[model samples]
Target: MLSVHLLTLIALVTSAKAAISPFTSRPRLQTTFSGLSDVEPFSLRLSPDTAKVCNSTTPGTSGFITADDGQGGNNSIFFWAFESKHDAKTDPVILWMSGGPGASSVGYGNLMELGPCRIASEGGYTVDNEFGWNVNATILFVDQPVGVGYSRGQRIPTGLRDSSLAMLRFLRQFMTAFPELADRDFYIAGESYGGSWVPALASTILRSESRSSGQRGALMVQEDGPNLSPNSRRGPKINLKGIMIGNGLVRRSVQNIGFFETVCSGPASLFNSSQCLEWAPRAMWCEDNLAVCEVDGMKSSACKDAESKCSAISKVVVEDMHLNPYDFRRECHDPDSCYSEMRHIDEYLNRSDVKMALGVPENEPFVGISLDVFKQWEEVGDLWRASDEYVNHLLQSGIRVLIYVGDKDLYCNAAGMRLLVDRGLSWHGQPIIRLRELVPWYLGTKSAGLWKSYEPLTYAEVAGAGHLVPFDKPEEALTLINSWIHGRLPAL
Candidate 1:
């Protein structure tokens, strides 16, 4: 059975805590900000065991940016914008979000994947990740749509429209908060349900009415306050350069085709060909139901049935096969998060001192995935609708996009992502990408992944990696991203 917060959402937005023992919280002092206006860099002590020998500096600014929750009052979106280890002024900014419709980016994206620090599971401490994404870019890991992670909102994230708008409002506030980094090239990235988030936010940014160079927006002082007046601060347009998705879920029906192939006939199939054949009929039913739901409302009963049945397929793998949905290589220890390391991360983030340093609300629990966020999203049947059309919009706008998947993932499997890239996504570049073949992309003379690109859109598959590619293959993940941002992925 699934744990309360542990149902899908990718890594978190859930309720389970790690069951590890003997690792008690160690107290450490950290600078706290009184307001959302402060942008001074803050540092955290890395290790508690050997403070002197292993202590390292992880410099970043953490705080909340208030937005209007659709229900009135205000929504506080928490973000940790980590400074680039290389160049703070000139390096690109990467805004990273986690999926699950309710998952916290802090758990899945930052502490686990490309963040500067990695939390140790055994001793419940921290270590510097030399391959952190901050090595070349300023990465902001946001716990958004209001109630995820350290953020406390007036209500749960109800739908994609609301969540994306909140993200836009958060970015406006983010620009006002950090003017020094305003004009820097910005890119958005996410995984799982973030597939829906990344494109929606990008599209909203493209579609928002305020596109002028000189635009100032008001700021709300409190979490339960009214709208910002004209006497506040400035918010410049984001220099949104590109988008990157790791093991993303874009097209529901097309990805369904990929799912069947992943388990049945793909290069990384977990089930035998004969075993996969038995499940083919249900896959077809899911695809048909989703098609009908698209014509009916996204929240229609037909769509709900399809969503329920499709989820049952994954339930089989998790329950009967005893494998994690994010990464089949691991056992599903926690229902929502699928990994025990997530529990340690949960325990670490909830530590009093850590919360104090981050200036999180004293009582707000650090949920990996909020069941509240998930239930609200599902009730509306929003999960079945596809976001690939938004991907096409980004491509047409001349913004670059990188879609990389971990081969071992089950939920947003590599095969499905590839299928979406090939014929599933509807764009002018669709035909161009469909005809191209994936060539080997090397990591120091050894093959790490297969990639094919035609500018604006680059699709790759990370070898042996799972749902969270950066978490499973940090070095390769970094190399893939650094290559994509700086230049094309070199064949040599």
Candidate 2:
């Protein structure tokens, strides 16, 4: 349930619904870049009325792309781009992904989180989003992993590596189509399972760039020929600068070790000390088993069996409490409507006029979440894998990384995030340690959060926010991102 204060903030950001603009009169916007010419048929201009809701004159573009790249066959990924309200040439491009390992960035990042427009459910239209992250950069929302949201395909990528490869291919084509974004500073942000997805994708991009530049060595060629090297021919390199993950499941070991500790004794642990103490031995057991599973040359069967035991230890808490694992502050309700406003986004997107305006095929139904994608990964045993090493690679390669979480979130709590960054990962053979103690971060006078940094890596705890930091503390989320992009630490 939304608090009175949050509801007030929502009202301030959303305008009373305006009448819908005529779809027939809206001019078709075409991309002049040759890379995008092939995708011209899928483009649609957002209505003037919707543009007004964003309090900007810039019209947005929404379309579908067959992000095949010959590797993933043909997966149609749905995307929507809101060009900077300011200058496109000067602004950075930020790609946003949502976790579920199967979630839709379109549904979570765009309508429910940081995008510039909010759906006014009562009025059945969109309204301005004052705390929108687009104030400083061009934000791209994608429905990914092949089967999430509007992205449709015969088969979805099962593991993180395959999915990241698919994303890399899609991004190459995306940058080619929108050449202006090719040179702009780029960053990827995501939450939840995104902790794994973002790192995997960043690792893919970084490795691709490194291999293409011949930084490591000669690109390995397969039996076929020189063309056998995947890096032999590559598209334009993306200007990736940094990455941010909120309440992510980046490393299973750290998450598992810290889970019982956080819930039993940390700042807002819901369990009694006795209960937490009882779970302590089990946590260590799970952690130790995972350590063995992570050993080099370990068998997949051994890993799968160990992971099952590890998860069983954690699942006990989730099953026993019946509390929202995402946010301990509340009881678990309808998973879909847990964050009530999310339901409104569904209503807004499902509108026939809204779908037509966005160039979605008239008969294709929109799905906010895809269970098929999730179950497939479970079957393939890809859910409990880790991406900490990949993130470490990015950190060593000089890409800035930010790991943050809502202190109030139970699943990916701030304590766990702090543990992962400080103790779990090593950079250049040394543990990542904070240069300074956690300090207050404010949006004006209000202390909105606490932050600490180790130069290129930073960790933060949003004070009252939950799993969805942006939605719970919009002002602070915006400030945190702005400070990050500008290469400055967030301060008063």
Candidate 3:
């Protein structure tokens, strides 16, 4: 007899798989966008040459659009679209967003991560990645909020927090430019800080469609009733198929505190120990209106010392064990090596294309934008919360929701995602976990595991991946996503 867990897993997978059909049945739709009256519509084409890395053909296209600032300025939003031969119009569209609050989706999000391409060599062109997401659907790589990538803006905006507005403007402009693709099914997807951007953008589309009419307008609504009535005046509801976040930073309060606690304590008891240490201090600080933890002469000194020690240890682990290819145990660990790596990253960013993609001026000083963005990331977070609420409202009104995460990602860990799902949305019952084993997993030859089916929403865990699961395990990620969008769940 099968174990109860395994039985439940099979049932959930079966139900999910039964939901949608394969991509072959769906035809590709020509995409166009509005708001860019000046630019011309163009079709995406495959590069004649195959990539050297994964030895796969990757498709790409370039286009321009008029993006809005919500505050009043309208700028050009240039973009690259990558699609696999298997992709069709009816296939779900995964819109990629890179973190950095100022990162380039094309560089990191595409070449290095999810898209079909990977950097062949240092400062070189890319090759196709076999693990790319395009095998199932169209992957749109955008340089967003203007001023990022080849996209240009009049004045560099500072601390702008309205991702919802930015998305609304971009979509409107994009659709206007690519009117032929108005009917394509779309899903908002991103990583790192994108945890906030994708949700917020999806929410904006949901809100907009709630007031419009037609198939595109009704896309956000659930398949079942409350059907549209003859007398209804509101626009057609926007259908949101699902959302995928890799190494996300969705729960600001939890992630910030958790990171401090998790990496600060000794490795053996780190996770739990950090939480306990934080509990008391956080509770007291909250009760005292944050006054108790405020920086002061003696307290400041202690805090600084603690921060240095934590930083030192974290640097060593993250650099030596994580990013570099050196064996963690055998390599001689050097504290300064971490600093040197940071400097190397700085030098890498100095490349013109990289600087352009990052929206950084050539002469501007390079501080840690990742940390700085965290400090000022609340704006995007607020937008994300609002968007998530809107999406849930759509669900309550009959829309199905799907959320996925990559397991190996430290930034957007599975634990944080679970907490977000549990607290952010109310479900009909307990979430279900369905595990599917992928043959010949990368890094190791063992089979990989994927989780599926969490109530009305489908939550998946992609194995053997980090912040960019698609980049590391593209085939599995694409298969899982394609299956989810089609409503088919894989067998474990």
Candidate 4:
């Protein structure tokens, strides 16, 4: 059973509810960006509660795209698309996803983080987020893996490989619906668990694009198993310009160790050198299990042991040290109600009128994250396995990649991100990565963080931010992405 704390994160992420059962029969449906028609009607407006009280300066729409994941069943992904404030017709396209293996992108990623509007207060109201990502680029927030949020499908996928394949199928359907994006510069971005999803999806897109397009890179990843059917081998390239990941959990072993290292490294250290020595044996065991988990995919006993080992470290930090796993600088106030905004966000989304405006059934319960989906992923040991090989391949293929981490986040902290760049990847740029000096990255007049860049890769650490950097430092996060998408790397 999941701990009370774990279940209570429901508030931070979204409402809590059971996962929707797979449909025995799916509807014959089709949709388009130009016009909303067919099985699902589309609406280009938020609820009255949003418009009446929120400073929603941009226009957006909600719709669903149904696609059959050739592996087993058909999938329908729900999406919220916000047009660019500057010029939607000419701006680049951004594909955003939230990171819980089962988290709602529209729930936490949208309302809580970088969405066009934020939860207003204790009641059901919303306020404008001046730093919303759509300021210059159109953003598509997708609820994925078939069961998170309003998405529905044949079944939840088993591992990173299957989940990614499902997302690839979704993208093909997405491209068919939004033809205007066919030639636009595109970027795939996500955080946390998205660490695996982003790289896996990018690799598939590069490897599976219509071979005639010639944009297909010769990507060979371990996740693209031999069972992949040739007929299921098409993806949307969309002039993929780059990818951005924030505090990603791409390499679990390094991050797991980094968590402990963080508590023992600074002036505010919770464990001194001698105290840290006690965990040396346990750390060794954790690394050994992770190595087995890496090679075994989802079915190894070692992987479950590894998961326990990793969670042990987190438990110590949160329970014993009394520190918040996501933001180590803060004390663990209450796992169930650490942030009051979460509860209000949940209440606002569950409103009948709000659901109606978003084209969702008024009676269907809203869940921010699905425990059932999370359990499915955990059973297969997906979280412990590494997606390093895929990310490394993408880097070597000359795809522009930006990896950023919050300095204060211990969950997927900066130390781990740095190790991922140094030890997890092998590429042409690896030779000079260490030789280059890191420089201060400024948001405007003051330095917000530190960064380093070489054409294909840029890595940075945002100061004074937590696991959700965008939520904690909205202005800085906006400046970071604006600079990145506009080709002004290492400068905000």
Candidate 5:
């Protein structure tokens, strides 16, 4: 599927490797500040033979491990930093987190999608990728919650709600381990469920910094109380310039109920024969649609052979597929067709050393989490909501929050994202229009539209991208991110 021009760009970029030092016999432990005796200094040795597949022109490897503060916890945080061939010292740091309160960052965020090096099926050699994010920034692909990636932890929490606690401990350990990065300008970015993690972590860092005079200050107090400091406070009061969430799941209640009905109801009515299908109803219609047409999920005997004539519903079953109440794709959709692209990406991910560094097993099952974890995740789904207070706190502090959505992703589509932004942002009247256009600039032949509109915060739709924007349009994504960081709204 890669074009000749893209392949040519890859070839051009793949041959350059002088930007990064060759693997040394000793690890490189470059520190910035002194007087941190409690923390042990460590160096990183990048695998020399590892191929750089993301950009064919930049000769680079896949992974490197960095030490981080676990924050009073016994576990140590280890992160994978992807360097750019352009320049390391001056390059901005883009910290990437993948969604999945339980997914591996290196697997999903790095090798398969955004980071500099992607996994190549041939000989494990790295190729240059023209669309890699490293053309402008140094990406730190992190696996949080301890037991993630190569980082070790005593226990994996059974529910998704425990993600915040895990991240707090991880950030503490991460900062402690890499005291050198304490003052770097950083941006927290992610996709899917990470919509929650990025903002929550940013807020945590801000609160942590607000407490003390210097970087090592005490955690900030919560908005509510004096003695009972909620699990919210922890981490550095980061000079967090901005945040980007692609296809995130931060506004759960509104997204699932309000947006779901609006976009899917019309399609559902086209396939279902039941007159019971009324707009704005607070119930799911699986049986009516199945009785009328061959809708996938409602084929059980309960809907079969019933002479209850119903209207034919469309074959598109987005909501039911998501709310199947099961983590297994087989339980939700036709296994033969469900996640075919994801499975291919997974195949490449399993074979990469980048994945190994993140502690994701090559042969691990598609549904990585245990059944107990899934059940707990369901019970605690509400915990992922980002409160109005937190959003307000950031805006009050002048932090820029950018929430982006991929129109094609059923799980966290643009419609849901728009609803969330409208609800959270306090903008009166029509939101300020920053920029907009359907342009042809990236590798793809038919160009996608790019819109940059802001009202203190900016929300835009990255056309043609799925749940993962970078994977779908890496060059455009990188360009947009670079423009935003530089305080310039992108012009489509």
Candidate 6:
């Protein structure tokens, strides 16, 4: 009694699985880069790690890379790399993350979004994703912030700041192990909570890079000294190019302005007028609380108070309407399964063979999304506040930033993202204004979306897509990414 569409989905899933075998005979963790000769001050080798050939057909590596946890202990940050189909030596290195504050990039970014392959819905096999983003650039999907996935650590990070620092340590060590990647053009990309994560990490890197002064092939990480400028301090630098964030939560205050618009008058009329009317008072109340929170220090109780008040709008919608916060077209199925593929990814990653192949511990269970991490952030009042400052910092410092959204998303909709960028951003003490008119973006013969640019900042909206833009519009997403990295608008 399966519907025609459902039957077709199963057939495609089965056929796709046949194309990509779950196990590969090729040696694991092989790198195509020419070996490093010169040693750098910050360079340190990663150890106590195990790796294997996880996929024969897929190129590049998958393993846990050890990073110093800022504490004495070492934390494992899980990574899966899809080496570029083009020249690995010159192509850009793109690191991807999916936001949950606790989400697994290996699960959401890899298995569900832009990885070279995907897990079958029932979780028994793997399938080739032709639209994977590794076509021209090396893509590394990292499970970050510790305790998110295959990554393990003695302590869990409390918030974005801690998570960003851990990631910085991990990146340094990871690049050192594969020294050839150090000089390549690097980019950080993520979504959702990653809105905060991407900019925070980018700012940290920029700050470090600015203070370092290195000549020839040597770099040093300064531990302590009088603060110096970029020309004075001598250390290594990540060859950062730009960042791309998909439907991210940039500034909650700015985004909240568009919340009522989307919920009440969105294309689908997802909420009744009576229900929508009830939110006006709550929205105003939250706004007043948020204003007070903004003036209060980052760690002040007022911030937590504001976070609690503003969060109710979405909470009530989720609790009462039962709509998937990510998309208006579907009902959220269950508490355990937030998105459609959560269960499938959990099953695929936890399989004994799969774990052995990827060098994950056999005993530790895999969690697609860690509710514990989520709760921890809530407890510490880390969810609210704004990332516009970081974004502005990046722009003023010449780091290109792209914010793209799926028009169908209910949670972080295009309207909200547009509001965040157009109204919420400022650079060099001046408010950011659009440099170009919003225009149709093309993918082949069809109009895929709309895009507008403001020099280092660009805002895009993808048609027929939801919160998880890449998963909802793979081909268009790939095209959009390629265009962004290549310094061209996606017109083809």
Q: Using TM-score as the measure, which candidate wins?
A: 1
* Candidate 4 Cα RMSD after full superposition onto the native fold (Å): 11.3
Question: Which candidate ranks first by lDDT, i.e. highest?
Answer: 1
TM-score of each: 0.83, 0.82, 0.62, 0.82, 0.65, 0.83
- Weakest ten-residue segment in model 4 by summed lDDT: 1-10
Compared with the true structure, model 4 gives a TM-score of 0.82
Please give, for residues 315-372, the per-residue lDDT of candidate 1 as tens digits: 7788888898888878875556567677888887887767765656568789887888
Kindly list the per-residue Cα lDDT of model 2 for residues 310-377, writing each as its tens digit: 66534554566666666667776444556666677666677777666666666776777788878877
- Runs off by more than 4 Å, candidate 3: 1-56, 67-72, 87-89, 155-161, 214-239, 254-391, 427-446
Model 1 reaches what TM-score against the true structure? 0.83
User: Considering TM-score, which of the candidate structures 2 and 3 is the better prediction for this target?
Assistant: 2
Lowest-lDDT window of 10 residues in candidate 5? 1-10
lDDT of 3 by residue, 1-492 (tens): 000001122356553432222111212212221112222222211111122212246445444554344455556565666554574555556788887676677556766666676666443445667767777777778766555654555634433335456556566544433333345677777877676677667766776666655333211111222312222222212246666666665543333333333334445432355455655464333323322122332134443444343234335355645532111222334532422333343445455554444333456443323343333443332322223444365455545555666654444555556555655454443333323222322223445554545445666666656555666567767676666677765544
**Local distance difference test, each candidate:** 0.71, 0.69, 0.49, 0.69, 0.49, 0.70
Q: Write the per-residue lDDT of candidate 4 for residues 282-330, one digit (tens) a residue.
A: 8767755666666775466766667777677668778887877788778
For model 6, residues 100-170, the per-residue Cα lDDT tens digits are 87899988788788887776666666677888788888888888777888777888887777878777767
**What is the model-wide C-alpha lDDT for candidate 5?**
0.49
| Model 5: CA > 4 A from native | 1-22, 26-73, 120-127, 157-181, 215-237, 257-280, 283-376, 379-389, 425-447, 450-452
**Which one wins by lDDT: 1 or 6?**
1
Question: In model 5, how large is the Cα lDDT of residue 122?
Answer: 43
